[model samples]
Each structure stands twice: as C-alpha cells, then as structure tokens.
Target chain A: MTNLTAQTRHHLVTARVENKAGVLLRVAGLFSRRGYNIISLAVAPTDDPAFSRISIVVDVESNLLQQVIDQLDKLINVVAITELDPEEATQAELLLATLARSVEHDADLGVLIQSAGASIVEMTDQATTIQLVAEPTVLDDFEEKLRSYGISELQRTGAVALPRLVQL
Target chain B: MKLTGAQALIKSLEREGVEVLFGLPGGAILPVYDPIIDSSIRHILVRHEQGAGHAAEGYAQVTGRPGVAMVTSGPGATNIVTALADAYMDSVPIVVITGQVATTSIGTDAFQEVDTTGITASVTKHNWLITDANDISRIVAEAFHVATTGRPGPVLIDFPKDVANATIDYEEPGELELPGYRVASAPDERSVAAAVELIAAAERPVLYVGGGVIKADAAKELAHFVGLTGIPVTTTLMARGAYPDAEALHLGMPGMHGAFAAVTAIQRCDLLISFGARFDDRVTGRVEDFAKGAKVIHVDIDRAEIGKVRRPEVGIVADCRLAISALNEQIAKNSAAQSRDRIATWVERCLDWKQRFPFTYEGAGTAAPGDIGRIKPQFVVEELRRLTPPETILVAGVGQHQMWAAQHWGFVDPRSWVNSGGLGTMGFAVPAAIGAKVGCPSKMVWAVDGDGCFQMTAQELVTASSERIPVKIAILNNAYLGMVRQWQHMFYEQRYSEVYLSPDLPDYVKWAEAMGCVGLRVTDPKDVAAAIEQANAVNDRPVVVDFRTDSMEHVFPMVPAGASNDEILVHPSQADQPR
Candidate 1:
C-alpha cells in the first residue's frame, strides 16, 4: 500500500464534457461522495458542437490514480478525461492579477517581475495588472520569486494542456 | 394583473424562453414551488442541490443559454457553491435563484437564514438579495440578461420568503441599463491593422483558436480565415472542435497533455494570432520559454483578458468573430505574399512530429490467471473506438485512464471529448456521460471510469437504470487509483497506502447487479471485445463492463509541471530518466 500523504502528488486535470445540464453535478458528486478535496476547478465547453470541458486540479497519490480514473469513467456524460503528464505535456495557465501600482514604479519590483517570467499587462493608478503563463509549479516558484512585490488581487485561469513534441 | 413575486419570477423566466429549471424543493422555497406547480416551466428534481446547479450548468453549456437553478436558502444555497464556482471559472451562463428568510427576519439569524448573497458574491457574475415583491420581475429579467451576456457566468438572485408570497401589480421591465457593463463588439482599428500587418508579413504564422470562436459561433469565419491565410491552427482544451480536428492545418490541443506538434509549433512560430484564448499555465510552462520566438496578437471580447498573459504585439478588445471578419476584409485589400511554402513546411513538421511519439499504448496480450487480470486501459479505449460511432461522445473520470483516453482515442470532432480537464474530478465520468446522453439522446455516450472513481458515486447507476438513460460505462478497474499508486511507487519508494481494493471488487460488481444493470467482469483481455458487445446490447438500462487491469501500469510521456515541455518522463517506473 502506498503511503497516502508521502506518495501524494498534486495534478491539474482538464476535461471536455458535453454541454448539457447536470454534468457538473455528476462530476462534483463523484468527487465529494468519494471524499476527494478538489483544490480548484474550471469548466467550460469548446467552440465545437455542444460540449463543455471542465478543468479540475487536485492532489492525490500517484499509486492510487487508477482508482480515480475508473471512478471518473462511471460518470454518464463525461466524454474523455486526461491526467496531464506534468513532465511531457506543454501545459499553460493564465493568471490575471491586479498588483498595487505603487510597486510598479519600484525598480526592484520591476526587476523582480521580469525575472519571474511575468510582465505588466496593464497599469492603472490603483493597480498594476500582471499576467503570468507558466506551469503550476513554475507559477508557484514565480509567486515565491515575486514575494518582494506585493500582490493586491489575483485570479488564475487554471491549467490547460497540449503535448510537446517537435515536428520534423 | 396582480401577482406574487413567485408568479412574477415564473413569468420572467417564461418571457426569457426558459423551458426547464434544475433544482430541489425545500421549506424556504415553498412559495416559489407553489407558483412553479402552476407555471409552464418544467422542474427536474435533482438528487442534490449541487446537482441542480451543475445540471443548470450543463443545460446552459449545451444550449448556450442561461441555466436556471432554484433552491432554498442557507445550506441549499451553500451546497450549490461548487457548481457556481465551476460556472464562474469556465464562464458558463447560469442563474441560481434561492429562497431566503422573510424580510422581517433580516439580521436576526432566523432559522435557515444565511448570507447566501454575500457568500456567493466572489463566485458569481452578479448577485442580488430582493426584499420587495415588486422588484421580482425586473430583477429576474436583468439576472438572465446579465448571466447570458458578456463573458457568460453564474448569477444569483435571493428572494426573501415574504417576497415570494407578497402580492403586487407586475409589469415587465424595459431594456436593462447597466452603464458600467459593456462588452466590446467591434475591433479597434489600430489593433486590427497591426494584426493584419503581422499576418501579412509573417513567413510562419499560427492561428491559436479557442472556445471564444465556438462561443461566438464563428467556426465558418475561423475556418475561412485559416483557409484563406493558410495559417496552421491549434486549439486550447476548451476550444476543441472550433475547427475540424482533421483539418490539415489543425494542431491538436497545446498545453499540459496537449499534442507535441502543437507545442513545438507554438515554440517555433514567428507570429502567433490568438483568438479568444487566455494564456493559462497549463499551456505555458516556464513562461519565459513559452512561444520564445513568436510575436503574439491577442483578440478577445473581454477587455480584461487583453495583455493578461504575454504582452500582445497587438491587443484588440473585440468579439473574435467581428475581429476575424474585419481582418478578412482588410487582408482582401492588402496584396501581400501568402507564404504558402512556409505554411506547408510547418504542417509537414507537425505531421512528422505526430508520427514520431504517437499517443499509443502497447499490450502484451497476456493475462494472469485470477479474478483480477492484466487488462490494458488502451485496449478498452481502442475497442470502444471501434465499436462506437465516430461522433459518439466519450467522457472520462480523472486519473491514469483519462490520460490513456487522450492518447488513444482518435477524436474526430470537437466536444466529442469531455472531462474535468482543469479540475481533474475523478468521478466526473458517470454523471457527465448521463448529461451527454440526455443532450444527444440519439448519439452513443460512454462514461470511461476507473475502479476507485467508479465506486465514488456508483449510486448514479441506479438513476440511469430507472431514468432509462442508456449510458455505457467501461470501468478500467485497476483495483487502485492507478495515478496515485504510480506516484507512490516512483516517488515514495512504493509504500502503498489506501490504493488497494482487493476485498472490495466483488462487492462493487454485486452492487451493480442489484441496481438492475447488466454487469460484465472482464478478467481476460480476449473478453474485452465481447464484454463491450454485450454492454452495447443492453439498450434499456445502463451497462457496466469492469475490466480488471494490471495495477502496475502507468501513463507515460509525462512532462512534470514546472519542467520545460522538452523534459518528459517517458515511463512511470523510470522517473529518474528524462526523455
């Protein structure tokens, strides 16, 4: 048996479900009934016919992932599920944050952000909006990397993914 | 005519052309329930208030209309928060109506009284606490308009119990006037010009289309632009089916778990034209390395989205369809090199990459002699692909199997693939499949689940059986939550935890049979085809095919989140080796 806490690794998953009513309930019910704490989730349908894709990011043991997959398959309208390989997939997520503009003028703050892979997307007198697109871990690193520059408000788009292989 | 707030609520809903409302009846909502019984609107009694909220979300998502969810105040309203937040993040249009304590009991902490409006304020697009019956009609109308318009999201309207019962002379409100809220429609001239110039001058350009195209219903226009400009396109997870998956220029999803070719293209492109896509973390690992060579031009309807990621060379705050149409018009006038050769080179590169590390699974065609055998998840996905129609909707639970589905399932259409992509909800498949089956009754729907996740809400199988929703469930029973187990094996020195379910297998199957559903257990790989065939035969009720798979199996081609996309872990067992 895997040590639940010691073996657990956080994963961010995004799925596309048919754009129908009640699908979200079914998805959430599955997690809650199973006593899974979903750290964050973002769901929306694609531009295709009538389908909605939900992105759910959570933490669990790697050894027990199969059980999770099997349980997910039981949901009626869930068309497909993908547990993104943090190492192989080209994952990107959006973080829309409004930082106090007072710090934007700080030379130290400007240098800190530039080093953290973020840029000032918008600047207003009250807030300086910064945008960062990176892996969840890197984003975390960048967040820690930007502690010197205070963050007033923040919003994340959660994670979305595509594979990363070079074409010939 | 004089009417109660409840009656006005119903009228407002009817005026907005809402035919169905997903919710549950409770004490606080008795007044609304009374009027609902007399109204033409049909109410679906969900098993849980949370289910009602998600159901409304599903309805809104499928129909592109505002979903209506009604419930009692306090816990009922609170229970629906998850779905509300889900809709909020995904931009789904849903209106949640809750019954509050009587107006007289404002801050007295009456029985079942809670500050639901304040509780949901951060999660909803807008929320209102109505104390007066006369304001019901206007509030309801405005709620629907707000929820459906702009970047669609959930809206909440809390009605006091007395307000629902209070009688008043009602008249539909005039046009909604919210001066502070304005979604841009037309593209700014300078940005459009800059975008056109970027597209015209580029030797290698890519159109990163997103759900906004589908949201705007601009598929034809998007397709037209891709065809005319010969620019390759890649979609975000939410933008699947924005363009035909089979299109020559189409590079599949680009992000964590997206196609490699798409990522490489993003990395190598000279110019990137983004339509309705916000740069999320899953798509941009090590942000500085994201699209290192490209000049990005972002066009979106939400002004807040512009420059929300990498600073765009040209940021146009306008509807994608309008922007694309305007660009098409301008491109027609500007005589510039189409650069067909460059576009062709990129396409060739993508095709070559796809041929290299093709998303596939290898089966040894061997099974151990036991109740739990070595059945590969890929075989199930592959077999289902063969048996089901190409357009069949396949939903999956979160875990190792979900990754297998993404790798093995050949998605021919957009929306054909659905799951909890961002949240990674494990037990999402069964109910999502039910919703898909409900949305497209004529189409085949399959809920691909794993053993651990399947047992989470297996009770839903009873609902499918009783409701006569013929959803086919293929359980990838690896006995443990495989993804978690793999992590334990690789990172934690294989100290197994709660991942094993050796004693629970038989009970799970027995439970399915008791629910009046046909249950088939597959211990042998050879029986996979037959089991699927038998499950398909059960048209009257839901069918479960439990394939006992090897617990040691793992999802490969993994790119650890913080690492660069190029750094991949090819297999679960070999964690130290980077591909």
Candidate 2:
C-alpha cells in the first residue's frame, strides 16, 4: 500500500474545458482511468460561459504528481490546467447540517454556532438547519462540533478554488 | 455546399484521406452506403460485421492511418465490440461508424434502436451520437483525429438514420480542437543524457523493441542506433519486423517461446534499453523476477506507460523516432563507438546462445515416409516462409500458429508483420489479411490461421473472393483448439476437456470452394511447398490450403503462463507454472 500521509494530499487542480456535452464525463473518465484520487470535484460554467471550470482536489502521490498533471493536461476537451499551490491559492466549501429537534439544549447550540462562526438558516418543530461557508478545513472541524447536536442530515459542496490576488 | 449528412460524412472521410472502407450495411446505414457507392472511397462488403472491423484494424496496423469501418445499428454495433476492444488493447487506430435509430425513436424502443455510442464508450477512445445533420462533417473529422492522435485507439461515431437522411449545409471543420491529445513529444534532455550515459557505460546491454516502433515509424532510426552502438535487439511480437530478422544484432524474440539466448541475454544483461515497448506481462513473466539484474532505460510516447509496469532507472516519454534520432546524434557526437570492444564479449555471448539453441523444432520439414500422417505444423510454417516472397505481409490468428509465424517468418522491415498482439483475438486473420492486401496491393499477403480461429471468421473468405482480394489462407488443421489443447496436455493432467473439435466436421476445402476460393489440402509434409506454390499461383482468386498437422506437438521454450522469463520450461514435462 502507498503511504497515505506522504503520497496522498489535497491538491487544487483546476481545468478549463470546452462547455460541451460529455465534457464532464471526459474529465471524470481521465481521473478514473489515470487512477488519481480525487478528494472532491466541482464543475460549473466559467465567466465566459464558453467553457467550464472543473476544480478537483486530488490526493495526488508525489511520485505520480507530474504524470497526473500531464494526463489531465492532454485531454482534448481540457483547454488549460493549473495546480494551485496551498501557498498561493484560496479555497472555500459550503456545508449545510440539519439537526434533529431532539437536541438537549437548543439555546446552547445557538451559542455554539455563534462561537464556531456559523449561522442558523432554518428552525422548525422538526429540525434546526445550520449553514457554514468557510475554508474546507474549517468545515471539516465544524462537522465535529455539530455531531453532539444530533445532526439528521448533512450536505457539503466540494472545494472550489482560485489563486489569491496580491497588490504587491 | 448543401449535402445530405451521408454525403457530408463521406466527403469528410475523403478529406481525412480515407482510401477504403470495410463494412456491412443495414437499414440504418443504407443511406451512408448509397453515398459510398459513388464516392472515391472503395467499400469492401464484408460477410460479417466483425470481419469488417478486424479488416479495418489490419489495414490500420500496416498503414499507420486509422482504419475505417461503417456498420449498421444494433447487431452491427455489438459485432464490432471485439474488434474495438482489440484495437483498444493494442493501441491500433480505427474509426468505427455505426448507424443508429432515428433521433425520435432512440429511447422509444423502435426497430434496431440500440445505444451504439453508449455501448462502445468504454471500449473506444471516445464516441459521439450525432443527432443533428450539421454536426456530421465535424464529428467525422474529430473521430478521425481522436482515433489517430495520442495513444492511437479506436473511436466511434453513431449516425442516426434520420440524421444521415437529413440535408444541411456542409463545411469542413478547418482544425480540430482537441486540447488533451498530445503528439510528437520530444524526450527531455536530462533523461536522454541519463539514457545515453547508461548505454555508453554498460558492457552488456540489450535493446528491447515493441509495437510502438512501428506505430511511431521509428524502425529505421532504431536500426541505425543499434547498428552504430553494436547493441543486440530483441523485437517483441508486435514489433517483429521493426528490425531485420536477418541482421547480426537481431535476437528473434525475448519472452515465452523466445530464443533461449535472447531470453538469457535479457536475464543477464546489465542494461536494458527499451524503446517504444511496454513490459507486458507476457514478456516480463512474473514481474518481480523479470530482468532481475538489468537496469531498464524505458522510452515511449505515452508518459503514463513509463513506470506503469517495471520501474525504469530512466524513463523518457517521447516519440520513438524523435528520441532515437536524438540519441543517434548524441551517440555520434560523443564517440560512444569507443565501447564497441567492451560490448564485444557480450555480443559474442549472445551469438553463442543463438548459435547453440536456435528456435528450431525437431523433424521440421524432414518427416520420414512413415511419419507422413504426422505433418509438423512448424515445418508447414517454415515452408510457407521459404515459398513466400521476402515482402510478404503475413498476418496470423492468435494461438500456436501465431507464435510459429512469428518464430519462422523472415521479417525485414516494419509493417511486414501484422497480428492481434495485445488482445490475442482468434478469428482475426482472414479479414485482416484482406484488409492488408487491400492496403498494400503490391505485396503478398497470407493468413496463417488455426482450425478454431478459422471456424469463427472463415466466412470472410467470401468477401475476399467477391472483391478479388487474392490473399492466401493456410489452415493448420489440427482439429482442436491447438494452444488450449497443448496447455491442457502440459498442465491440466491431460484431461483435454472440450479442446477437441470432431475431426469429421465440415471440410475446409469444400467450405473454401463454396466461397469461390480455390481450395487445396496437403496431407503429407512433402506436399506442403507444392500446395503453397499452387495457392500462390492463383492470383485471380483467394486460395485456402488446409494442411492437416500433428495434434501431439506443442510450442517449445515454454515459460508457462505467469512464470518468469528466466524460469523457462523447454518441454512440457518441465512446466514452470504448475500451480
């Protein structure tokens, strides 16, 4: 087995691909065929709408890193490929956690949400829904905070990224 | 100009320089056939859709251009599955166009409404479903482009019946926008330097060649490098003719059933310079034990293939021609010729191995009068090699005969040998031979097939006969799935399950005659050459020579499946992989 900690790590890989039918399949196919471990993938229309931007967080082995980049770069549908470095990129993901109404302390959960930098989106007799938009790592920790509240359902968007702009 | 989708597609194929198309038409593809009848592209009507597909593969293997196949929907699409899979495995370029039900009737379960593109997606490099008539030309062009570029694989374009019937304004797509496909990659300078250093320093080095040499058309450059560097070359099955078999540096083959010396050289060599060849399981045997002593310098056009199997000391992802030529220049500049004397001892050792236990079978072409009933199949192959011209492009169906053809044929240049290498598909020879003959009309072509393989696609002879494609077929009639029987005999306690077909089955000669081919049967060893001569003389029609061979014989220098190349079992009793 490959060394999980050493070989697997989150890499922000963005691909600008033709906005056409089956383009997503092609990108997904490349990932599967090449055996790259994609932690998360998000595809959406770019600003121009002529092409789609596919942001994938891959657990890329250091040895297979160049190969992964080369393979992804060669797909005809993929117009451009960029692997955003952690030092140079900003990343974000959204999480929505629906907590069951059976929580022991609803007022305490509101205080916990305020302290954890989250907001209550909906509250009803059935459930209390909380939404958090933050860095992927922050959401991962926030999920642990919601665990004691007896969350019934949870949904999280895959990480989306862009290179950080600097005035310098 | 205004044109029907079928006309536009045909025009696009012609624009892409397609000379011939192999296909079987049906209701869905009838409109396309109408345009093909009048177009400059010659259409060869095949007996089965499978034949058309394999024939196209053969054509592409020899020409380096994508073979074109056009078949109707449903059964036609499914029939091509094997051929497409074969191309996918071997990286042969092919463009298969299958017709589909009309756009409205696609999901309505109308007659012949099969999801051709969906079914073929996994097997092909890419596939398209053309619902609009306007997309016909661009789709055809892109299909050809995608099929030929990158790793070179079969691509499919599904043409719905209504789309083919619809009229639209057609303009040829000026250029394809395939951002992912890479072509003609040059080797990295550092990697080349590393490879050159290894090649220069090694006293015992071997040059391993594979099908990519032919694919990249780098045989000439490779031969030049080997000649200048005095390196011994072992060509793999797919790369049989990439270097001259008669050359002094040649090491016939280097895997299971390969020459004892060639296999030994690989095992003992200090440096193995691999060019355009993957270390396939068949060649490497047990991967852990293969080339245990050699440090491999692997070069190929595909980057992912570099360390996919055996990790190389130096891996260069570049076109074989470009890499070899650059290496040639570097070697010439650096005076790498100084090491010729150092490699002399190694060359002599390889030569001694070749001279001592050459790939030869006992009683080959020299059977006694009493042994007339037992015609050696190897002898038949040797005789075929002797009788055929030097330029003969021999294609073989997979099995014992394919090995024999590879072992005995005198291949001197690239494209002179064509076979299903990676897939090892049976029933590939007949149609492939026809396709090859069609592609290289001036050259002699022969289909060396086994009885089992012949039975699967023998109907193709009718297509060959009808089209006047005069390729010869040599059926080594052992009355069994020869290789499977040999395996059962060698390892399965001789249980011989269902390997044998009844010897009293349909006569191949009569079957050949029924298909308008000149048929002959040679029972004795002495008659082998004469029968082949007769078959060769029948230039006006296709000929089938049924040579009944001894079923007891088995291919030697056997590595047994999954055994290391070095753990060779020359005879059946010494089976290497008993487990």
Candidate 3:
C-alpha cells in the first residue's frame, strides 16, 4: 500500500498582514478556497501595532510552495510572506496539559516532568496542570509520555517560527 | 469641506473619472442614493441588483475603465454575488458598493442586513467594510485603484448605514499606502531574450492569447509581436477581439467550441507562447495531454497564474504590452534578416486546416426562400456579422449562441466583443449590451442571446429603453438549453431531461414590445438580413430580433468535456466513433 503521508512535505510560511478587521479571514480564505491543507495556523499582533504576523504550516508538495507564496502575496491585506526553512529556523510551541494526580504515581510523574523539562503550573487534590514550551517535535514526545497519567485536558499553541540571526 | 460619507463617495467616484454607474436602491442604501441626484455621474437604475452588476461589467469591458455598481445589504448584496464572481473569474475591473446595516447592528441580524464583506471575501479581488465616515473617500479611491490595476478584477466596498449618514470634514486622501501591492510593468530583459530565442528556434509556434491582452490595452503590441515573429495566433474565448479575425496569422478562438484550426494548432504546435492567458481547463482540455509536444512560454501580469497550471519553460511576470514591446524590439534587433520563410511551411499547413475546416453550418447564407423551419443559429450569427459594421460591438450570453457569436463575428477591433467567458453567466447579454452602449455611445452594440439565456435577465431591456441606450438584441430562439441538449443528444443516450425550455413561453416579441423596444421576429430564413437591418435602423430605441432557429443544431468542432484536444468531435460523423 502506498503511504499518502510520505508524498507530502510540511511548509512553514510567516506573513505580515494589516492589523484590520476581516484581514485574517481574507488570508485564511485564500488557503481554504484554493483547498490548500493548512496544518497549523498562529496569529498575533506584531511589534508594530498597525500590523499582525501570521505563521502558517501547510502540507503541500514542493512544486506548490511558490504558488502558495504567490497567492498569499495577491491579498491586499498580506504585507509580506517569508518561507522559513524548518531546519534553519528557530521554532517553538507551547503545550498545557491537565492530568489526574494520585499519591501512587506522584513520584513517577514528578520525575517524568523534570526529565522532560516540563513545569507543574497548578496542583489540585484531583488533578495537576503542567506547562511546557519547546520545539514542536519535543512537545509531541512530552505530550505522548504525559498520556500515561490520564490527561484530562490538553491545549497546544501551534508552532511559531522566525529565521535564526546570522553571526557577523 | 464638510460632507457626509455618502457625498464623499460620490465626489471620490467623480475624482476617479467615473462618468456612469448602474444600480438599484434599497433600505440600507437610501442615504447613498440621495447623493446620486446631485452628482454629475449618470446612474442607470436597473430592475434587479444582478442586472446592475452585469451592466457595470459590460461597461467596464468596453470602455477599459472600472465599471461601478451599488446595492443594499442582505438579499440585494447576495443577488450581485454572481456578477462579482463572474468579474473575478474573467478579470473584468469593476467596483461594487453594497450598503450594510448600521455598524451597531452588524451582528444582530438587523433588517436588510447580512455580512456583505464576509460573503464577498472570496469573490472580490479585495473588499472593505467602512466603520468610520472619515475613511470613505480614501477607501473609495483605493477601491477604484485596486480594481483597475495589475490583473484587473472586481472589488467591493461595504458601507454601513450609520457611516453613510455620518458627516465629517473631508480631506483629500494622501498617497496610497498599499505597501504590499505593486504592479511589475518593466519587462525582464533576460526572459524577453529567452522568449525571443524560443521563437527563433521553434519550428512551430502558436501565440495563445487571452482577455488580459484587451485588459492591458496591448492589442496593437500583440499584432506587432505576431507580425514580427511570423507566429500564428489563437485567441481564447475571452480574447476574441484582441486579434483581428481577418489577419493572416489569426487562427481563431481556441477552447471547447473553438474553430478546428485554432484547436488543432494549439494541439500540434511545438512551442506554445501564452500571452496574458491562463491555461484554463476550457482552453486546455485534459491538461495532461494538452500540447504534449509543446514548450510553454507564459507571460502574464499575475505571477500566481504563471505556474498554477502547466509550468512554463519561460515565465515572465510583466504587463502584456510591455513584454510584447520588449520582445518585438529584441526580435527586430536580433534577426532583421530572418524572414517569414523560417516558419512558412507550418503557417501554410495551419492556413490549409483553417480553409478546409471553416466554421460553417449547412444551408448557411443560402437557406431556401420559404425554408422557415430549417433556419440555423450559425446562419443568424453570420447574417448579423454580414449586416453589421466591423467596429460594431458584439455581446453574448452563455451557451450555443455565445459559441456561435464567438466563431462567426470577425471582430477586428479590440474591446469590440464582450461576453461572460470564464464564469459563463447566462442573461449577461442584455445588461452588458446596455452597459457597452452607455460607455461607447457612438459605437453600435448588439447583444446576441439564446432563448434560455435571454429569459434570465430580459427585464434589463427596460432599463436600456428608459435610459435610451439604443443597444440591439438578437435572441437566437432554439426553444431549449441548446448546449446541454446537444450534450444529452451525444452522450446520454438521447434522453433529453429538463433541458427543454418551451419554444413559446412569454412570447419574446411581446416581452420586448412591453419594454418599449422595437420587436422584430424572423421565422423565415430569407428575412434574417432584413430583420437585422431593421434592428440596426432603430437607433432611437432598443430593438429585439427574435430569430427562430433549429433546436437540433449543435456547435461543431467541440472538444467534449474532460477529453483530450486530439479527440475533438469535428462533426456529426465523428460522433459515432467510440472514444
């Protein structure tokens, strides 16, 4: 059987858009209308209040990368688009997980959390909440390991990336 | 000066050189309509909002200016969505101003209120919803600028009721702050040189032209480029009038119902040079197999369109005129001695194909005097072509009559042919013809419509009559949705389902007369010319000539849906052979 997943590559594109109502929808609408698969999307205000930055990760072939960029550039609200190389760019994501807390597995959970570089943010008699900020791949591993403790709730901020600064 | 947002909208349009607009007013748009009476811009009140949108498109198509349309929120805004989509698909520059509910009541589901901006986001090239009265002038200016520039397309501006009623001190907007938007007009010399090299070395080359040529006003440049290169040109449906049909190099339109020579030329060419035309599915049937032997050279202003379909060997992102001019200069400078002798054999072969498989119907121009039942649609188109002047503008609605008009009308002038090429919107003829006549008052405009299509928006003729637009209408009455019926006849075991729109519903002649138009009916084949002449003579009012045509007749040289261009069905005899 052929694996459909093997044929596709993940692409990260960061775009600066006008900070205006309906602008985000305009950008998202282009992807949806064209039927481009958006794997993850993260949006927030930029340093300049007049503009917002949207980081989108899409599953597409290499041939369609330029088309994606070109289409995004066509939108009036989209100010600029930059494709960040996953290998060279600095990428990060945040994961928040609420897990059941019991005396029997408390020591094991504590050791697991410390080893995975995750910090317990809240503690209750019934449950414990942990937060982790790391590369998406690392968070995926940590989240998988946390599932053994019975994760009640989990939330993830999709990856945000920026090009690494070059040494002078 | 202190002015309401509505007043500023009118003043801004005047500043943008808008002389005419088409619209119908409703609740939310009342304030904007009030300013129209005092404005210098003449507004044509249409029966429906859809009619208003199409009329604007027709105006823009002929005048090479941004056409304007206005409507209220909710149903009114939704009604014009088809026209907006049509303009977007065809890249016709138009500005649509739709009124919305008061900003306070935007999300409350207020009366005559809908998310106009949200609904039109995908359809428009760009749109804006004004929250402040101070931003009206700048937004209006920006709307026009965005609509007309680069790859021209439709733009919509949604005006909330409260904003339109609010008064503010008007200040002329400063320089446009579209930092992201830029039009690349300068031709890249390296790409131009490469294209020229391809032309020189190519054994058989065909210039696949599209509507962008006319949109770019590059018809003259295109003519010069083809003449210099000695390349045969096959214009697309949207680009019918971009190249003169009488020119020796013109191979006619290439698409589903294209001429045999045009279809075959694209299929057979060793190199395909696309100028301002996207390789649309209608043009390149079964794209994988389309022009398998050809190396593509695509030049369009929109970079997104370059490799979106078939990847071009040499893709140049620049205006068609600038690119063509650059190519012409480089070719002239590089090879002054190279004559038409290089590609002479290939040209002769194409011309031979054109001569052998001419776009002709049986009994064309020579129908017997009393042969009333045998009148063909192609014959009527030919009669109109024969009777009208070369410069007369021809507009068509969707379906068989559209294909026939595209095939028969030897359009020699750019901007002389208008139709919904990409979207194939029916009932585009009457309103578009009215718009075309309004834009080009001195030029003759004739709308060639089909029976099924004519019934869709025939009420627009009333606007044409009341406004004294004086456009002519030729309804090819085939009594059925002819194109669909033809497909059913050929493909679906001859089971005609739901395609038969009755022959004599709402008697088109009486419908025309009721709209204050001179109605002429031609059942006899011999009266075709006289009827057309009579329609042409009525310059004071609109004229509708109902030409009863053969319902069984099919548009020939058709590339069946999703089939390769190589397997085109040229005639009925070829239809029997299994694919």
Runs of candidate 1 with Cα error greater than 4 angstroms are A1-168, B332-337, B364-373, B486-506, B513-516, B570-579
Q: Fnat of each prediction? A: 0.00, 0.42, 0.74
Top-TM-score structure, candidate number? 3
Model 2 Cα lDDT, one tens digit per residue, B1-579? 999988988999999999999999999999999988789999999989999999999999887888999999999989999999899888899999999988989888888877676567657888888988988887888888788865788999999989989999998786765655556578899988888898888989998898888988998899789877999999999899999999877978988878677787898899999988889988888899888988999998887688878889999989888899888888887666436888999999898877665666656435453265677888888888888888888999999999888888878889988899888899999999999999898889998999999999999999999999999999988899999998998899998999997544879889999999999998887788789999989998999999888888788787888988877866433334221
List model 3's recovered fraction of native interface contacts, to 2 decimals. 0.74
Q: iRMS of candidate 1, one decimal?
A: 17.9
User: On TM-score, who's better, 1 or 3?
Assistant: 3
How accurate locally is residue A69 in candidate 2, as Cα lDDT from 0 to 100? 75
Task: Tell me the lDDT of model 1 at A154.
Answer: 82
lDDT of 3 by residue, B1-579 (tens): 999989988888899899998999999999999999999999999999999999999999999999999998999999999999999999999999998999999999899888899999999999999999998888888888899999999999999999989999998877776777878787899999898888888878888999888999999999888778788999999999898999988999998889888998899999899999999999999999999999999999999999999999999999999998998898887673135777889899898878777787766545463354567888888878888888899999999999999998888898999999889999999999988999899998999999999999999989988999899999999899999999999899999999988767869899999999999888888788889988888999999988888888999988999999998878654445332
CAPRI grade, predicted model 2 = acceptable
CAPRI grade, predicted model 3: high
lDDT score of model 1? 0.73
Backbone atom clashes (below 3 Å) for every candidate? 128, 4, 0
After aligning candidate 3 to the native by TM-score, how far in Å is the CA of B522 from where it should be?
Answer: 1.1
Q: What lDDT does the true structure give each of the candidates? A: 0.73, 0.85, 0.89
Model 3 lDDT on a 0 to 1 scale = 0.89
TM-score of model 2, chain A? Answer: 0.90
lDDT value, residue B551 of candidate 3: 87
